[model samples]
Target: MCGIVGLISADGPERLASRVAAMNAAIVHRGPDDAGVHLAPGVGLAMRRLSIIDLSTGHQPMTTADGVALVFNGEIYNYRSLRAELETRGYAFRTQSDTEVILNLYHAEGMAAFARLHGMFAIAIHDQRRDELILVRDQIGIKPLYIARHEGELLFASEIKAILATLPCRPAIDPQGLWDYLSLRFMAPDRTIWAGIGKLGPGQILRRKLCSGDQSIETFWQADLTPGPFDIGRDYAREFADQFVAAVDSHIVAADVPVGAFLSGGLDSGAIVAAASELGHRAFHTFSISGDGAGGDDELPLARAVARRFGTTHHEIRMARSDYFDTLDDVVRAFDEPYGDATGAALYLLSQRASDHVKVALSGEGSDELLLGYTRAADLATLAKVERRYGPMPRPLLKLAARFVSPDRASIFRAMAEGGPGAYRRGMAAHIGWTISDAEKAAFWRGPDMVPSFDLVQGWYGLPDTAHPLAQSQQADFGTWLVEDLLMKADKMAMAASLETRVPFLHLPLVEWCQNTPMEARIGPPGQFRTKAVLRDYVATRLPDAVLNAPKRGFPLPIFPWFAERLRDAGGYVPISREFHNWISLEGLKPIVARACRNERRALEQLWGIAMFDRWCAVYAD
Candidate 1:
């Protein structure tokens, strides 16, 4: 894994080296093992290498003998296979690095080489022959790639801050992007918080011709969700288990250095360890994080059970409220954007702990999005059925009920009353319901945009072009939230600690197959209410029922209650008070803060969102 940056200028390569060097230096934490630069007449590419493979010879900004150069940031698990294929085609390679495999494959197959790739990557290949720069992100966008265009030049980087460092220009904030962040907690693709810079959407590729000044962006791939004509119903549980185990085995086998797994008390991570153990890889190292407070503590016992069962080396770290308060700046700075996910703290802590034992760690992310594993999905399905029956509710009555009712319960009623496109959009915005007032929402958001968050899901469910709702939802996520938000968090937090995180469950083939499977097939019987039912069934055979059936307590954190109780104590330490004192109404925050201290669950998430946004403004906007 590594961080890459490049500047393409029509003005020749005079300051390119110094500019690229400055950009790469900003994200040196991402790749501290080595650094390399490739400078040409009009292009400069710089890379910081973590050196997971070909430790001695894999230094990058790697170039072919013929002058084609490539800067890459990710792992190509199928490099060995691709190398063998390239060899048959008369291409010779000097190194075992996947970077070389990519350069050779590009030389041999052109853009078609992307179709053959099966790993996570964000690649920038400069074709010296064509004077063109080609940028491609992985199919699922497990890695990040950001680009900005300025005065006939294009700047690209693994992190936004790196690009900002080189240009030293602050673009206007995109209003829609700001709205999305306030409502959804993160920016969507095709939009960045910074107006001029845009994220390269997943499954998409951008190609620029330096000579002709032409640029084209297109979707190179997508998960196939069309159901197959024939049905093969032979113990899907066992078959899925076998396939999952094989996928995890393949992922772990690719690491050139010591690797480990992040073991939460949930089935996702536990299942990975169980499968790895059964695959004969003993002595795997596992890491877990726990909160010190009473309400936010973790189930370390469950994690210990899996570790003991497999006899793996287990490491646990306990973090107090003070630790979270103190590290807030580090976490916010690591993410170049204002990310509102509280789990960022937990992920950062976990990665910091894991980096001590291994260079790479297997994680269980993307499973929730692919498998309908969130409670909101099940809730949306139930509400959709109700909305179909109650299609004629008066707006005023519904609005009145929404106001008097608690936000948690009101969310359910709102979901049922607001049908069609609006329902899904509202559901998507449910997490940040505190951002706008009813009066303000009426004035600001309208038409399709005003539709509930679930409407995005509904659009997927009712896609005129697609048949599978689950698959459509996955596609939407890949386009919007997955890359711009979740993957950003994963990459930044892991790279912050100089650790590599691989998600076997996010393998393209597995996702493609799951997309085509019917929702019924994936979820099993109605009313089961068990998200990821298919995977759960697979886990049932390989893991204890307790692990498989445990409630999904996602990377738990105590931010809300901790802030409520400790805000005054953290006054001097908190980074936001100076700037936040101007815009945010602290008086308005009192009720929410009071509710959080009283242990009102739903209020806490919204309260934390406000606090996070406040701090973000202090750091970035103030």
Candidate 2:
């Protein structure tokens, strides 16, 4: 993995280098081992490398013989195959790096190359001869890329902060982006934390010709949800197991570095470890984390079991309360946004320690979203069916009941009444978006009228009308939450530790095949989280029974008590930043906080989210 920055400007190459260097510097934690820059007439490309593949020889800002420059972040698991294809086409390679393959492949295929790639990547390619610069992100949006067009320049980077570093002034908060976060704890793939700077959505590309100053942005691919006949009666478990092995094998292949797995002891990561070990020649290196005194089901023991089963060398990191508090600043800084996923703190620390032992690690992210794993998917599906029948409670009634009723019920009612798009948004907000209500959202923002996050999801990429309840939920998240929240956390936290984390479940062929599979095999009953039903069946015999049956507690953090204690110590609304002080209203949540402290423990997620946003602003909003 790496930090990549590119600028399309009329400015001199010397001036552009300094700006791109600063942008690259802001995200140095992403790639601290090596740094390089390439300058064309008016375009500049820069990258900081972590040296994952071809460790001794792969220095990026890698180029073709005739001077087409490429700066890429994330891995191209299928690079070996792509390189072989190019070799047959009479292309010569100078380094054993995917960077060289991508550079040459783009030269061979141009825009068509994205379709052939099969891994997570944010690519910046500058064609000096054509005088055009293009920035592309992977089809699954597993890697993030941000773009800004200002003063006759198109600026792009792996992280938004890198783009921000080149700017003269801090960009204003995008109100829509804030609402997107308030409603979902993440911006839509199309929105960034800042107003003017836009995020390049998944499966999309931005091509800017420096000569004409004409830029074209469009999607190159999408989730192939086209309906097709699938048979569940067949031995799907074995088929899925075979596919799992293939994906894990591809993700774990490294030239000089030891590839490892983040053994969460969950169904997915554990399966990834098993597949990596069984399919590859290398022994697995596994890592896990625990809280020192904050008590809960420590996954260390379960991870140890998996490690023993796989014959992998295992390491664990334990974090105390102070460690959690101390890392909050760094956590938010790493994300470059107010990411409220509390698990990120733990993952950040785990990655920090894990990086000490290895450079690349395989994670089992993206499986739940693909396989209908999130309990919310089943719940939303039920709500969708019910909405079709009785419809939802009236809006005014739901609004009136907002305080008396749970935020979840209010959101359910809102979705039932609105139907279609609102269902997923309401369900997601109630569960993961800190359960903030519409009324609370109204009070949270003090800018232009806010857009509901669902509108963006629906507009940008909603499921087909033929998609089932489970499929609807999965596809919606596949576009929004999976990209913005889950994958964002996975990428940033791992990169923050200068570790390259690859997700086997996110492999495109696997995703496409699974998405087209029968919904019965994908999910169980509503809200039960029988996600990846077939997938689990596939790996059932491979992983320990303990891991298979253990309840799906993902990166379980005792976050509520921590936030509650902090709140009691403060005696009021905790301020995260000047913006948090100014824009986010406490009037609506005051009673909720008191009620939470008394009996309603679930309300503390919002408090925790507020504290997280505060820490982010404390670091970046300046």
Candidate 3:
């Protein structure tokens, strides 16, 4: 909803305000409605307000009478109740703004109160009396926060570019981060492609006591991955449906400004729109992003149908390959990294279009991760069973099949043979991502530190921590794929367009409800193999048969044909750049490029990934 920036240092308050102004200027798109700055002896805080809540009074660097300044970048869905509690404690009223409530609550409870709040927020609170800076991100990381510690100054912001304003030089690429992206298609959450900068993981808090120049990072809350008992007979589906509609109602009502939704023809967004309309909420405006047969699904037809049925105003934006290519420069720059997901390109354009009419938009983002909605979950579970039974393929056989089989399948053959959680983890990434085999990757970097996709999150949310294979994959995704890539892409694209996108599915109350879902309902029997089975059941009657029975072609941009055409148009195989030689190896790059030139679908992603990284370098590095 807003862009928040803070720089705490011995960098003289006078100079700090000037530097903060420049930094805040970079992210004006995030909050074009209003701007404010707070500067003191040891720190400066800034925020761009979009004017969503309490439009008359909602402004930031919202300060209290006691000298505490708060700059936050999300909605606290439960702020009203939290306000009531604070009022009971005799807290004086100022504005009917959540920002005021947050400052007052922090005044009452300090940083410890973050756990008691539920919302998608990136909060930076500066306590002048304490000379302390505390940064908090929501439990699921729906909002982004990047931090950098340099030359006795600590910088934190809603986007990486704002942080880059203070240090314009491109940060060096971390070899480990590159290796991780090569394996998993995304960098680790705590790590970014740029060196000397770090993304604060979801549910994390960073506190810098400027007096002592001491800082530490800790999780304010953690996911309860412990499976909840799924009872189909106990009206749980009805409960999920009711709570989900309530969540939809809550998100739309958060803003005093006109609110809209980023809708798709898919069941997720359709379901939300229907729920909103049925709940008799205010006039609903819907937005959809479609593709121009350039490796993307055109959901306009169905999106229009749903919007019409719900009696909501609808807008559609169509994107072509050329459109994507043209905007890609800005897209990668917005990413500030080599994000492998092309959906970011479409999302960037979509948010840009949506921002024209509305300031806030609801989206269907976390549904897949929460409900095991991807079709691959069943295959992953099946592969795990096969691994458990046959004890994996021989290494020689895995290598032999690597050249012929799909990259995902080849990974299963290789990783499953190794056995245990690592295999399952690797298998999960293989199911959804494109990466070369370990043997193939070794030719690029045989360093002792290269982490395999299966082992991407060994210490947290990796395969070893969960029971079911589906659960294992979900955990891995929630930690890596969702946090590092999907959420990052969503935030950047939306903020770049100056639209505040909210995810109803990620509402903690709704997520906690889905966490109790049974494995059977998630992945189900292969013949049926219905993903999000409980959710499908809930919407079965509320939605049209066309929607309920539609195939899941989520953001299905026709990228293979586009990649093939791009390579052919460029005079056959694209050559790897000198940067690739510096980081990866010509030894490994040769065959991958060769395979892609041969029109191998598996190899296309690698070539595209390299090109994306180069494009990012073209902007930030070179």
Candidate 4:
């Protein structure tokens, strides 16, 4: 709903408001309607409001009479109920604002109140009573919060660019973060590309004391994927349909502003549009993206089919190869970090088009993670089983085999052959088409040898609670990729257009049910695997067979040819664009670009990730 920034400083309160003001200026695109700041002693808090809930009086930096101040971003779908409960307990609200509800809730329940909030948010509370600054990210990381430190001062913001605006100088790049971005296309949740700056992970809370300058971070909630018993005879498809409809309705009705949705021809978005129509919210806006030359994969016609079925206003943003190139700089600037995937650009343009008609849009993002939707789930399960049977393919053999294959197959072979603590991470990197190997890394890294990229998913991969390969893979993504990469992309891209995006599938009750249920309800037995089987079953009658039976066509853009052409025109190798470019040797990227120019699509995918990183360095490495 807004962009937030603040700091607890060692230096006295001189210019505290001005310093926080400058930080707020960096992310004005996130909140263009209203702005406010509160200063007390060594603490300063500020927010720019987009005004989704109570348009007239939802101004932020809201404070209670006892001197507790708060600035919040994102919406609380259950706030009206919470406010009614508080009113019965003798708490009189001054305005019809969720911000006031949060302020009062904190006065009543302390930190325990955060667990009761059933919505996406990044909140900062200045409780002078305890001299504490408490920061909380939502249960699924639907919102983002980044923190940085200089001297003894602590700063937090909704985006990294705001923190960078307040810094004395540019922070050094964290080598491991770069390695993770190159290998996995996103930074891990615990660290950003900058060494001293970090982000709060999903379901996490941080407490910092102003007087003593002490801090601690802890997880408040996480997905529990331990194998549990469920009745095999129960009608789970009907149960999922009912719950999903309720969740979508809850998201649609929460806003005072008009709510729209992102419609694709695929199963997830189609189901959301069907649910919204069934719930009687008709004539609402829906947005989709179309590529000029993308054949068979274009979902625009299918989106039009859904729109006609539902009687909704449909808008399609037509993009060409030139549009992809034109938006490259803006996409890098929007994320404020290195991000590689092409689908994010689609969402960015779609949200921009939707923003002209609606302030909040519902997206079906977390369904794939909740249910066993991705084909990679099956591939990973097969790899795990093969690893148990074959123990590992030897490193020298993998190295020798790499020469005979293209970069894409070489990464998969390395993943199949790798063992030890980082095996799962290596396989996941290959799953996403990262072609870099340890041998290649040694040749590319100009300084000391890079650490194993497996550390990127350590502690998140191979959780001890579940032994099922499918459950383990889902849990790993729930912890790492779901929060760190996918959710970050959704938040940044949507917020860039001053629009709020809510993921109905991530509603806590729905997520809990999917996580606790047996995997058989999602994907069937090993011999009869079906991706997102329950979801497909639920939407069987509501959608057309063409949509119901189509394979997963994820926001296809002609980016491979685009990346190949650019790299080829740049003479088949582009140098890292950072001010300090001694880390990665340009000579090592020659083979990848050469393969891409030869029309190896996977090689171009790897280069796309590298190109995004290089663009990020050019923007931020000053």
Candidate 5:
């Protein structure tokens, strides 16, 4: 519920304080309620507080008598229990803030204490006793943290912009990070768009020995993707329902302020609202975004239906095509890193509306990746089976036949004939909607080096070979796409509005259970092929019949029509900013723009991706 920044440098305390103040100023939107700075010789810790847990006395950078100091950005749901345990151990607390709980827990257990936390956080702890600085991100990366070292200074911050604020100059663009963004629309957790900066992955810890200036990073948690034995008679629906409701309760109650939710037409958001209602949590606010019929489902009616069912105060934000263009630059600037997802713009607007009513809002973000919610999972599984049956066929013939297919289907057809690592790479590329093929990439990409989507995590595709394809896809996405793209978007867009958004589905307990769920339960029967069958079954009675079976329309934005309109407005040419002149090929983008102007959907999508990247360069690179 705040933004944290710190530096371990050789600068004098005055210079350190001044630079840290500038960093804090850069992220005032993240924590407008309060701000604090702490400097100790060679180290400085700073934070901008949103003031959710302890408004009056939770001022930080909180320090101990022994000189251990902490600046934290996030809420710890299990703090109350941890506080009671610490108090039993004779540890005295001066405030009821979760920040104090973490500081005390660190005192008692050291690094092991982080494993016991059950919330989203990015923490910076300066241990004068150990003469080390420790930085930790939450288990699922629901919060964000960036780290960079330049000219003998070690810096960490909640957002990249904060780190950039302390920099003497803009860092060069990392080509691999840009390629990853172009291939997948987001960089991996370990990488950022800037060359020298690094992002802490989920469940990761980075420690710097202030004395020697040595640094090390390690992961403290990982998804248990290993499938468990299925007991057909165990009533998984009821079990999932119990834990899910408990998670909803946990997230909704953690904040002292009123909590609201994002309720789209999709089941994920709808189920969150239903769970809150069933638990007798009444009068809480809910928010949703409806389209102006540019494209995608008009989610307002379904959202209104759930609101009426729960009798909660519901707010709706309507988005038009013009809104996308108007706020495109703001959304790009908010990310700092180049991000191409248009849905972020929608969420940005929605979060602004929610901020009028509540400081914190809950959304069902991690459920789809945890459970098998997207059709791509089933499609990939089916593709694997088909590939196995067609393994012996001539590869070149299939490649030739692929040329006969439409541009959209060509890559998928080509991917179907390849097997092993190559197949997974191409399949993943297609899964993430990569509009540029390997052949196409070779033609136009002038960047340093391009990374395929599957290579985002070295040797990730080789793991858990015995798991079902569905399980593999689910696990892969949980690590890469979910943390990097979806959760990152959620954090940046919501924070841009100064609204703290929580994801109940990403609760560690629920995530662990869902990750180990049987493949058959995640996707429905063989012929019906429904996604997220377990979730639907769990909410069958709790949600309205219409919502129970509603087809999933993922935070869809009318990017296709929007891109076409943008191209038409620009006289059928993609506007390439001078910032990207040396990075991407205008000659290579010509055909894509031409196709977009003709209203080709995939071409339009690709154009949207490039256009967003252009805007990002204009904002950040310029």
Candidate 6:
């Protein structure tokens, strides 16, 4: 709900304060309501407040009676309960803000207090008593925290742009980070497009000791998927219904200002609206977006269906192709890094529309990750089985058959033939298959050391030292893609519009609980047909079967076709300019561009990637 920045140095206070002030100013959009700066001998803390709670008295850079100051950037939804507990222990609070509760909680319980709270946050706590600084990101990383160290000083911010403002030198682009972006569309945690700036991984707490110049960072929570067999007879449907309702109810009450939901007409968003309606908040505000062109338009009709069902105030925004083209520069700049998700366009527009009516909106983000909602999961599982069965087949015959099959069929067969957890791991890497030829890949890729998506997958599999393959993949996502990519996108885009996006499904306890539930209970009968079975059962208990059984429609956007038609006419495709040629081979991209113009879908994906890279270079490489 805010932007937090700070500078810690062994140098003079005035110099650091000036730099910190500049960094805070860069992110004023994140917290236009209020701004505060505190400068001490070796530390400076700056905060921009959105005034979500305790608006009148919640001015921050808040300190305890003992002089430990805290600058926080998100909501601790359970702050009231933590406050009550702290009050019993003789910790007197001067304000009702969650920021005060967090300060006191750290004072009373030390680092262990983190486990007792539930919410999304990125906090910078300066303990003057110990001459130490602690930075903690939320369990699921709904908030972003970036850190950089140069010349015996540490700079941290809620956005990379803030840190960029403080540093005198140009940002260093890491080749590995760029490679990751090209291969997967986004950079991974512990790595940013900038070489020196790093993201604090989710569920991680980092402590920097001033005297020794020492830092220690570690994960405090992880998903544990060791569920026993499913028992449908135990009234699980009813229990899930009750828990779902309670979870939605609690999240709805967390905001201090007028709140609404991102009603996308999908079951996830629809179910949330339906639940909120049943809770007696009759007048709910909802928002949705539709693409401008014929093929790019989405399921706004379905969104309307849910809105009408609940009788809520629904607002719709129609985005023309020209609108997307116009905003491309701002969107890339807003991200401050190369992001490949085409949905970024839709999300940015949606958040902008939502901001007009409400200060905060609930989104259905984490449900798919927690519940194995994507078809890729089932495909990978099936492919693993096939690989095991065909291990002894002749390689030449396998290759011949692969050549004859369609790309989708070949990919599944190849994945299955590869077999084992490692193979399955590689299969799930985002953007694993090449839409471009090997020649094009070689030409387009400028980095000497390219990391295969498999390596990232393998690295994730080894993160927790656990035996659960499914859980390992999920945990890897929790650490890498979920936080670094999806959540990062959500925070940046939403904050860019000065809107607070709250995801009830991403609640820490709820995510942890879902992780422990059996996969069989979550992913139903074969073929990805009955996925999110557990969630469906829960919804069935609250509403009619019609609503529960509604087809799963993800936040769909027509990016592939949009890039081909709309962007094509508007000089959206980057020409073979010298700057682009420095990294990617123009000779390699030319054919791909030609094919994309010919309406080749696969070619368009590659063209879009190049176009995005070109656009990003134009923004950040100056």
TM-score of each: 0.87, 0.90, 0.90, 0.91, 0.92, 0.90
Let me know the TM-score candidate 5 reaches against the reference structure: 0.92
Q: Write the per-residue lDDT of candidate 4 for residues 1-622, one digit (tens) a residue.
A: 9999999985567678778999999999999999999899899999989988889988888988788999999888788999999999999988888888989998999988888888899999999989999999999889999998888899999999999888889898888878766777788768899999998877899999989988999888878765456687888888888889988988988889999999999888889999999999986899989777778878888888888888889888888878877887898999999888777787888888889999999888888888868755557566566567545556567657767887655654565455432243344442332455556566666655567775445445554522555566677777677787788888999999999999999998788878877766778655667788789887889887788777787777666766677766777765557553666667777777789888697777777777777778788785
Q: Per-prediction RMSD in angstroms?
A: 5.0, 4.2, 4.3, 4.3, 3.7, 4.1
- Which scores higher on lDDT, 1 or 5? 5
At residue 304, candidate 4 shows an lDDT of: 88
In model 1, state the lDDT of residue 146: 92
Candidate 2 clash pair list: 373-531, 392-417, 576-614
RMSD to the native, candidate 1?
5.0
Worst 10 contiguous positions by lDDT, candidate 5: 421-430
Please, what are the lDDT tens digits per residue for candidate 3 over residues 330-362?
Answer: 998788778877678888988888888888888
Please state the error at residue 46 of candidate 1 in Å.
0.9
Inter-residue clash pairs, candidate 4? 1-74
Task: For candidate 5, list the clashing residue pairs, or say none.
Answer: none
Report the lDDT tens digits of candidate 6 across residue range 1-622.
7999997887687687788889999999899999998788888889998878888889988887677988999888788888988889988878889888988888988898877779899999888788888999887788989998888788899988888887777676787776656666777668888888898877789998877878999888755555546665665556556767777877878777888999875667877888899998776899988776534346787778778878989999878877877887888878988787777878888899888888888888877777766645556565467557655676556656766887545654454344433344333443322234333477667657565544554556443322334555565566666676678778889899999988888877677767767766667655544667777766655544455555665556666777777546754455533455567766656777777877687777777767777788887775
List candidate 3 stretches off by more than 4 Å.
294-297, 375-384, 387-431, 442-454, 457-466, 524-528, 573-581, 584-588
When summed lDDT is taken over every stretch of 10 residues in candidate 4, the lowest stretch is: 424-433
Worst 10 residues of 2 by lDDT: 425-434
Candidate achieving higher TM-score, 3 or 5:
5
lDDT of 1: 0.74
Evaluate candidate 5 by giving its C-alpha RMSD to the native, one decimal.
Answer: 3.7
